[model samples]
Target: MKIFNLPLSESTFEKRAPFYGRLSATIEDMRGKTKLVLRLLLLFVAKHEIEATNWKIIALWGMG
Candidate 1:
């Protein structure tokens, strides 16, 4: 899933899968949510890997 990028166990991911689906009933909103999550993850990863920056991330995964 293009949902979260963190040290999450299988149980935790599966536990929240239903809620992720509940982000929206429309296909467009769901897709947007996925893309937004991925973009945020890419930014976080790039900041740490490419720029050699240190970040302490505390994430709450959901639709705003």
Candidate 2:
């Protein structure tokens, strides 16, 4: 992926440590049930809230 002319490779994405180490660690330490809740919370965003219909909209909304 390219971000502002900076190239980011697949391996960079696979390793979340540099970007989200603390949040990742917190998620990792959660119980199975808690993890499930977290996943649900993350996936439960209302479509209308984001209004993302395509990749471009999704990217713009995500960045904004």
Clashes of each: 0, 0
Worst 10 residues of 1 by lDDT: 55-64
Q: Which regions in candidate 2 have their CA more than 4 angstroms from the true location?
A: 1-30, 46-49, 52-64
Task: Give one digit per residue, the lDDT tens place, for model 2 in 1-64.
Answer: 7544422777766675465667667677786679798778777765534555566687888999
* Candidate 2 residue 64 C-alpha distance from true site, Å: 20
Q: Write the per-residue lDDT of candidate 1 for residues 1-64, one digit (tens) a residue.
A: 7765643788977887777667545677878899999999999998778544222222222321
Task: Give the alpha-carbon lDDT of every model.
Answer: 0.69, 0.67
- After superposition, candidate 1 runs with Cα above 4 Å error: 1-25, 51-64
Considering summed lDDT, which 10 consecutive residues are worst modelled in model 2?
A: 2-11
Best by TM-score: 1
Judged by lDDT against the true structure, how good is candidate 1? 0.69
